[model samples]
Every structure is written in structure tokens, then in C-alpha cells.
Target chain A: MSHHIVEFKNVSFCYPDGTQALKDISFRITHGESVGIIGANGAGKSTLLMHLNGYLMPTSGTVNIGDVYLTKKTQQEIRRKVGIVFQNSDDQLFMPTVYEDVAFGPLNLGLDEAAVRERVDFALNLVNGLELKNKPPHHLSCGQKSAVAIASVIAMEPDILAMDEPAANLDPRSRRLLINLLKTFEHSKIIASHDLDLIMDVCRRCIVVRDGAVAADGPVMEILTDKTLLEENHLELPLSLQR
Target chain B: MTFDTQYYNIGFLDQLSYKDTFVHRLDPRVKLVVTLLFLFTVISFSKYEIFALVPFFLYPVLLMTLGEIPFMFILKKVLLVSPFAVFIGIFNPLLDSGQVFIFNGFTISAGWLSFISILIKFTLTVSTALLLIATTSFPGVCHALRRLKLPAIFVSQLLFLYRYLFVLMEETMRIVRARNMRSFGERGKDMRIYVRLAGTLFLRAVERAERIYHAMLSRGFQGDMPTLKHFQIKSGDVFFALSALALLFVFRFFPATEILGRFVQGVFL
Candidate 1:
């Protein structure tokens, strides 16, 4: 059986303003593999993540999840298979309370209230965030907000998790907690972040994109060690790997 | 970070709503109807009828005491927003200077009496509105509106506005703080910088809404926000509504305060 769970088959995307955000991006993510995507600020990392769950349909080409090509008809199932966490916790945690935010996915899936409650509780407990269930998202500290955001997505139990800038704006303790939580997720992950230390700690393989196209794809250590590639892609070796 | 973020109390009323009390436990629809009726009765009084408005205060006072809400907090909040109503009412005494009442050889202008009535109405209406939210959650109010056959779009917009009010205020406060820090006493406080700051805030809000939409789409949101919790009206709700309506009827048609005052004077004499 093929281990691949996500495949980008020459997928290209363009914004409504005629800017080509992704240029025939092709890649495969095997099940349970964690990959780090490194790129410059506007190098299309987020656009690529958006395509995984069919939020933005490709201008050309196809995105397949478990051999099912992404289409309007299959979009529902595709979303269940892949969950994307945006960079900002505020954007993701839109519901009034943490419990409601976590239950949002399951309730939308038409699950019974009891089942939704169970899932929300489970997810919150998994993230050590059960105590935050009734608190409003706005009242939470920055770290708690990020944790609730992740729990909200995790409650859906998606097969693939894609996180954008998972560690940005988080203090050290929260970042460490996030890294440990991500490690516990038993699914394929694509983390696009500028936090090089986070990528090294959680990802074994790395992909570098420059100017809307893939610059390099190799083992994490090999890519981080290569000074020429790191500088070219607006990245650097993680602090742990320095010297 | 002294972000001047004192507006964090935007949800303080919401927190009060979660407390378990007889007022909070009543169905939101019942509370909504009673509050509206109370407001109507209070406003229906004549311009110079201050005695009739005295009895109307019982409804809000009952709610505050039953709901365990602090009277001082409600008073402070009411005072904060009273300036607008006070400004409008202040003109009544100034514009209309006709004598209406005589007490102990002193004459009071009809305009002053009307001005006092305006202040009374303002106190009753604003306090009732605040207490309604304090006892009934915002979602509860939105759910009641939806059940009352209000347009889904209107209720959802209200829900969104209430939910995001905190987020937007915090963001605005942060921007203002940054502006304050970078500029000297009067450097960046001009109207030009204010306009540009507002323009940037507007763009940021648009971008934030787009991201929120994307997040919703990824989670199976299809056109509507579905709520799992359902509301059912119970006998307690019906009883509460009936008693409130009875109070309104008695207070509206009967001069309870004037009769009580006359009885007190007769007994003393």
C-alpha cells in the first residue's frame, strides 16, 4: 500500500488580482510524516496550505487526498481528511467560548450534541486546555488562545494537519507545549513557519520554496546545513544546529 | 504594554449572565418580552408625570436583586452613557420655560418637570437594557430573536458584532498605544494621523474577516452557523412572564406612588 495520503499533482494557483501564488507545485506527503515548509514572506507557503483542504481551488491542476481528486463534490470529505490551522489564533478561535469553538467542527458535521461535547472535552484535555472551555477566547492569554485554536481543529480528528506559523508570537513555554502537542498528533503534518528551532525539533524533512516555486527538498539537517540554500530561501540553521 | 485596554470589560455583562439565579434561569424570550413591555410603559408616561415613573423602577430593581447583580456596577455603567441623554434632556428646561407646579409657595417650570421626566425615563430604560444583558447571555438574546422570526442575517450580524466587539476594541487600543508611544506630546495626535490610522484599521479588519471566513470554510461551515443547544419554554417562564405583565399593567394604569404618598400624609396628619 502506498504510504502517501496527500498529493499535489502539478497544482498551480493564482489570486483574483492576477498574481501567480503557486507555480505548478508538486509534492507528496506520506501518512504520519511531518514536513517543514520554509520560504520567504510572500513565497506562497500559506497559499499552498490553503489548497490542501480545497479552501482555494487551483487555477490549474489537481489536489488529491487519498486518491480522491479535490472537487466541489468531494470538498466536504477532503476537509474532514485535512485540517489547516491559520497563523493567527484570533482568526481560528472565532466562537464565543473555547468549548463552542472546539465543538464547532463536530457540530457542523451534524454530530449529536452529546458526541460533540465528548469530542470537545477530549480535544481540550489532550491539549491540557480543559479548564479553558468556558472562558471567552478574547479573555485568554496569548498561549491559551493558541492552545484553544489547536484544540478547536484537533477536535475534528482530521487525518492530515497543516499549521502555518505555529510558533509565531508564542512565548517559549507555550512554544514548547505546542511542539510536544504536535508530536502527539498521529497523522501527516505540514508546518510552514519561520521558527527554525520548531521545525528542527518536530520535522525530519524540509521543503524550501523561493519566488513561488520549490527551491530544495531534502532531509532537514542537510537543508539547514547548506548555507547557500538557507540564504537563498530566506532561512537559516536552527539555533540547536549552529556550529 | 500599558495598552490602555480598559475596555476589556466589554464582556463583563456576559460573565454576569452565566451566574445561576432565578432571573438568569428564566427563558430569555420571557425576559425579552417583559423588558420591552417595561420600557414601553415607562416611556408612555406624560411629560410632567414624575410620580407615575416612580413605580416603574420596581421592575429593574427586582431584576437586579433577583439576578444578584451589583447595583453599584449597574449605576456606574448607566452614568457612563448618561451624558448623551442628559445633553438632550438639558435642552428641555432651557427651551421651554412655562410654570406648571406650585409647592410651598414655590413655582416649578413645566420645562423642569419635563426635564426630570426625561432623566427618569433615561434611568429606567438604560438600566433595564443593561440588566437584560446581565441576566440573559448575548447568545440567549440572539436565539430568542431567531425564535421570534427575526431575519437570520440580522441575528447573525448582531451575534458577530457582540462577539468581535472585544477583539476589535483590543486591537484599536493597541494601535492607539503604539501611536502614543512613538509620538511626543502633540506630534501624532492630529486629525491627519487619526484618519490614516482609521484607514489602516479598516483594512486590517477586512483582512481579518477574510481569514475568519477561511477558518469557517475549513470546518464545514455552510452558509449558516448551526447551534446545538436548543431552548424550550417552561412553566416557570410562563409564570414569570405573566407576573411581569401584571406588574406593568398595575403600574401603568394605577397611580401607585401618588396614592401611597397621600396615604402617608393622611396618616401623619
Candidate 2:
């Protein structure tokens, strides 16, 4: 039996201002699968990620995570299961101190103080920056802040980690470090990024989104190696990885 | 961008220590209560009541010395913000014309003394406010305000405003820098350009706020933010608050300075 963790069926979303963000999106993410969604700027990658965590209820169809339908009643539970790290680390890390930011998710989950501290330590250790616990988020380097943002979600121990543009605007070394850290997570991952190199390096499954619909979905190597399809969809294969 | 010459960066202040010192360890409710009470007792004296108000200065002095804050820094901030208070209080002398004291055989009206009293009160109150913030962080004050039974929505709004103000302000500063670098002097501050700049900043801020709301909702923020840490009042807090209150009461009610004057007079005569 296949263990499907997230299922979005015929999902369509339109902003309150009448801008359609996602259209008839149907996708199934199985347990422990690493999926990357690649698209242009306005291709609705963020809107889809929001749907996974129940931040946005689909205007048309249904979303399910581990047999539970996404609804107002199941929002808290769904959010606990699906952790989202936003594109901007500054937005994700709002607390005064690093430790507080890491512990924020677990504390919101109503975990005990001891358990929260343990989770915070575990998360900080995962980022390999335990010494930055006392430092403020604004004082951190861009890479460290991004790592702390990931650690903040990781502290909650969510089953699914959905990140948007996890490696955008980073130095090559920082980008390498982020990819290495992301490689260690065993949970089901959904990464939305324009960085085809990082996405191809980590994700085995690739989904191409264009004009608010899924244009193509298949193995990463096959999808990434197709130059004509990429150009047609306003995407270019990275020069280093192209045939 | 030209770097800001202002000494205190709000970003730098946010990262400072939140530990329990002799000051930080105080109960928030007690601190709020005592600060208010101290302000009231200092302000209640008659206009010509300089002698009585002299003893009240000791509270701020003790707070500064014990809290290990710089006295000059607090005084400078108080003095810097004093002109408005002075502007209001100066009218007292012009309105109230009552003669009370004869200094060197020239009668001086009580109105001037009262105006002076206002000046003293303004200095003390403003300094105390600065000292309170200097010693206690903004989050600590918000927690204190929450414990003091202030409106939860307002307190949380204050906390949220402080959290995002830095983020938004930094963004604003960057935009201003970019604009300035591209434009000449008059064009930089032009009305049309200013409106466009502000409009763009507002749009960015709204987008940021929307993202922040979603981020907050995902973390189980159901209208109220729950703080993980709890504050407990200790014996030191009680003793400190009570002793300060008792001292304020005695100073307000008794003519301790008059008695000291009498003793000095007796010694000199």
C-alpha cells in the first residue's frame, strides 16, 4: 500500500481581488518523498505551499494531509504537520533571540518547557550553530538567519517541510551549505525555487508549474534535461547541468 | 546611504540582555505601581513646595545607581525633551500673581516658585520614564503592562509594532538611500517623489504584513499570542516596593527638610 502524505485534488484558488493564483492543481506527495516545484515569478508556487499548511483554503477543490481534509477545524493540526519556511528569513525569524525563534513553534504546540528546550537544542544543533542561541536574528549573517529560519520549523518536528526559494540570493558557499543541510532531512519535502541547480541536486521528483497549472511532472533528471520544454515554459536549464 | 548619526539604534536595543538583575528581577505590577505613585507624590506638592520635592529626587538616584545605568545619560534625555514641558509650565508664572516670600527685602511672587516647581516635576518625571526604559527592555515593559491589567490587544499591538518597526524601518531606509543616490537634492525630497516613495513602501509593508499574518497563523496564533515564560514575584520585590512606597509617603507628609534647616540654623546662630 502506498503511503500518500499530501493529496491535492482539482484545487483552484483565486485571491480576494479576483486574481487567479492556482488552477485545477492535482498532485500527490507520498511519504518521505522530496518534491521540487519550479516556475517563473508569478506561477503560484507560494500559493500552493500555503495550501499545504492550510494557510489558504482552496476556493474550489479539496486538499488532504494523511487522511484529514483541509478545513477550518483541522487548520491547527494541518499546520503542525506541514511546516513552512518562507522565502525571506527575516519574515520567518521574528522573535528577539535565536533560541526563542527556534522554540516558538514547539511552544505554540503547547509542549512542556523541558521538551521545548530539548527541541530548541536539537534544532539549533541541526543547523550546527548552537553558539548563536543568544544572538538576535538581525545580527546574524544572511545564511545563518536562513538556517535559523529552517531550525525554527524543524524544532516543531513536522512530518512535511515546505520551503520557498531556500537557496535564493546566496553566496555559492552558503548555497552549498544550505543544500547539504537540506539533504539530511528525512521528512517529505516540497521546495519551491527558481534555482534549478539546488532543486535538481536534492529533489528526485520535479513538477513544473506555469500560468497557475501543472504543466509537467516526472523524474527530476528527465524534466531538467529537456531544454525545449524548459524554454517554452520561461525556464532555462542551468549551463553547467545542460547536455 | 549615509549612516545614521543617532546613537541609539532600535535594532541594537532589541538584542540587549533580558536577564534578572536587581532591577529586571522586580515585579512588573509593583514597578508600574511604584513608578506611578512616585510620579503622583512628586507632583502633588504646592507650587512653592521646593523643599518637600527635594527628597523625591532620591528615588531616581537610587534607581540609577542600583540599576547601574548612567545618570548623565538619563539626565541628558530628560533635559533634551524638557522644552515642551517648560513651555506649558512657563504660563503659570504669568497667570498666578500671589506674593509669598521676601528675599533680601524684595517680595517675590509665589507664581514664579510654582513655575519652578513645574520645571522640577517635569525633570523628575521625564528622567524617571527614561530610567525605567533604560533599565527594562521594551518586551519586559510590555509584559509588565500585561500583568498590570492593561488591555491585552493594545499591549500585543505594541509588541507587534516594535517587532515589525525595525523590519519596516530598515526597508524604508534602504529605499530612501536608493532614491537619494539616484536623485538630486530637490528631487530627493520632492512632493511627487515623496508620495510615490511612501506609496511603494506602504504596498511593500502590506505585502509583508500579509505574509506575516499567514506565518503567524501557521504557528497557531489564534488572535492571542501566548508567551512561554512566566514571571513570579519574590520577597525582594515586595520588600523593595513597600520600602520605596513608605519612603515616598514619609517625604510627602513630613517636613523633613524644614527640620534639617532648623538644625543647621541652630548650629550656625
Candidate 3:
């Protein structure tokens, strides 16, 4: 039996404005599983991922990450465990230099200066971005900035990596580079993206969301092969990948 | 698309990479103390003490030349921002009417010289402040402030504000450009449109701040920013402070400018 790294029990959330974003959603992700979350616009995809990182507390029910219940007290521990890379790299790379941004996480974790530097170098090398250490984020290309953003989070050495639209707004070459980089990570990943090709290629399991609920959850091949079900949920399989 | 082009501008030039020569690397506490002393010494002189004040210009000159900043750039920036100071100082001539030495056969009042003194003091103080920023990056200055035990919250806010200033300003400039491209001159300047434009920018900034907070929190930012490296004071910093104080003493007590002027006069006569 697979041990669950994250388990959401009947989780439901409403925005401060009383807008229902997620309704009684329940899911469990196992350790080392690459799960792709697919949904239409306003289908609660981002809301669900935000919960995994403790960015947003559930209005009802409980969220458990590795046996620790997520509350105000445990939010910090949960954040350290689950690193959520936002869609825009601009939000992630806020420091003056790339090295500083990458080192931010480890330094905050109370690691000594030498240890922070080591983690920063290791994280940058993981993304093949050791060359751009001294450069500021504003000076980097979009693809490079995205990689630096990933490095910034990876420096914390989080147990789970939750990425929202990881391949959004990238050229084919940059997208392929990002996918290749993602393939190198052994940590469990939950990727929410509209790029079905990347989803099918990188994720082992796929969860289709519709109207604040999980429409389908199964293996990537099973979901990708079901064209009717995908179209019904406003997600389409790429023509090349369709069989 | 590359954002590098946007980082190259007057603001970036003034804010970064101007060089931290021996003088620039002195402890900010020392520099701040010495700068205040320089200002007080220059301003405490009598109206007829023009010769004494002339030697004081050396401080700014050395800062410019040694710091590797262009003299003309500092001069231009100082002069451009000098009108208000000039206006305030101009009133001194009218307020105090006392006759002094005549220059070029024209009798100059003591009040005029004092007004001139005020102008010189203004230039020295403002230009030195600008040079301080030009030589030291804003972050370096903030770190110095933090080291001096200023309120941590205030210093941290200043650091955050400085870091985001460029980001927010660039965002604002993009919005202004978009507005300009879409509307004519007067239409672009309409109050209603301007208000809406500013409102949108504010909303965007707030949203950006929220996202930034989340990013910071995710990185284990527990209300404090921990630097990966620490700054240490070297022997050069001590030497730089001592030499600067020594120079200030020499210029204050001895009239070097007048001595040089007399030498030139004797040669000419």
C-alpha cells in the first residue's frame, strides 16, 4: 500500500467575499507520485494547490501533510514541506540578485551562512542555472527567470513541489527544457497546467476537475485516451498524443 | 523577451555600480558623523569667511574623483535640484544689509556673501548626500542602518520599499506607456482617466505584494530577512575615516584656499 504524503479530507473553501472556490473536495497524493491537476478556468485548480502549501486554510474540513495537521501553528512547517511555485516568476524572484533569491529560503530556515551558500549553489546547479547567480532577476529571460524561481524554492529542499502552470507562456524549446528539468526531480510533484502534452508526458496520474469537484482521477494514459471525458471537463488531449 | 534593457537607465546608473573606493567603504556611522561635522564647520563661518569655505570644496571633489563618479554628473544633478535652495538663500541678501569688501570695484554687502555661503552649504550638503547614494548601493546603506541598531522594522521596510521601488516604478511606467499609445495628449491627461489608471496600478501593486508575501512565507521568511553573508570592517575603512577627519581638521583651522590665492596673487603681481 502506498503511504500518502498529502491527504485532504472533505476540504471546502470560500473566498473572503463568500465566493465558493472549492466545494467538498477530497483527494490524496502518495509519496513520489507525479500528479497532474487539469481543470477549466475557475475550476478550483489553483485553490486546491494553494491548500497543499498552506497558502489558504480550508474553510471546512482538515488538510494533513505527512501526519501533521495544517493549522495556523503548523502552517510554517507545512510551507517548509510543500513549496508552491506560482505561475508568474516575477512574484518569486523578488530579491535584488538571483543568488540572494535562491539563498532566501535556506537562510530563513536558520541555516548558517556556509550552509545557505551550499544549498544555493546546489539548487542553482539543479536547474542548470549556476552561471546566472550574480545576475538580477529583471535581467534574465523569461525562461531563465522561471528556472531561477524554481531554484529559489528548491533551495528550501521541500518534500513536495506544487507548480501552477509550469509550462505556461513558454516557447516550445523552453517548455521542453522545463519538462526535462522537471523529469530530473525525484520529489513528489503536483502540477496544475493547461498544457495537456506536458501533463501527459510528465505526470503519472491525472485528476480532472470540473465545477469545484474532481470529475475524474486515474492513470495519465487512461485519462488521455478518454477524449469525450476530457472535452466534457473543458480539457483536451493534444492531437499528437491522442490514440 | 529580455527585461535587461529596462534596467539600463538614469535610475540604475545612480543606484548601482558607481564604485566603492576607500572613502566610500567607510562605516556609515563614521561617514554620517563626518558629513555632519563638515556641514556644521562650513556653515558656522562669518559672512566674510569666503576664503575659508573655498578649501571645504575639497571634500566633495575628493569624493567625486576618488569614488570614480563623473564630476559633471554630480554637478548637473546638484544644480538641477538647487533652485529651491537658491530661492531660500536669495532672501538672506535682502534680509541682512551689511556692507563688506568690494570685488571688481563693486561693493558687495555682507548679506550677499552670507547668502552665497548658504548656497555653498546647500550644494555641499545635497551633493554629498547624492554622492553617498551613488557610491553605495541602497541595500548597502540599509545594511549599515541595520548595523547601527536603527529600528529593525523601519529598516526592513526601507529595504523592502527600496527593493520594490524599481519593480513598482517599472510597472507604473508600462501602464503610462500603454495609456499614451492609446490616447492623444489631452485625453491621456484627463483626471478621470488618470484616476482610473492610478487605481488600476494600485490594485496591481497590492496584488503583487500579496503574491510576494506568499513567496516570502513559502521560503521560511519568519518576519525577518537573514543575510547569507555578513559585512566586516577592514583596516582600509579605519584608515579612510582617519584621513578624512585629518583633512577636515586641516581645512578648518588653516586658510589653505586663501594661502593658495595669495601665492597666485604674489606671482601675478
Say which candidate scores most in TM-score.
Answer: 1
- Model 3: per-residue lDDT, tens digit, B134-162? 77666667667777787778877887776
Local accuracy by lDDT, each model: 0.87, 0.83, 0.82
Fraction of true contacts retained by every candidate, in order, equals 0.62, 0.45, 0.76
List pairs with backbone clashes in candidate 3.
Answer: none
> Each candidate: RMSD to true structure?
2.4, 2.7, 3.3
Model 2 Cα lDDT, one tens digit per residue, B46-128: 76778788878888998888877766667666777888988987877778888876567787677888888888888888887
What 10-residue stretch in candidate 3 chain A is worst by lDDT? Answer: A1-10
Find the candidate with the highest lDDT and give its number: 1
Model 1 alpha-carbon miss at residue A52, Å: 1.5
TM-score of each: 0.93, 0.91, 0.90
Docking class of 2: medium
lDDT of 1 by residue, B1-269 (tens): 43343474556777898899989999888889888888888888888889889988888899999999999989988998999888888888778888775678788778888889999999999999999999998878887888888887887788778778788887898789889899999988999999999998999999999999899989998766666657788998998998988889988899888788999999999
For residue A108, model 2's alpha carbon misses the true position, in angstroms, by: 2.5
Tens digit per residue, CA lDDT, model 2, A35-91: 999988899998999999898899999999977899999989899888899999888
Order of models, best DockQ first: 3, 1, 2
Docking class of 3: medium
TM-score of chain B of each: 0.93, 0.85, 0.81
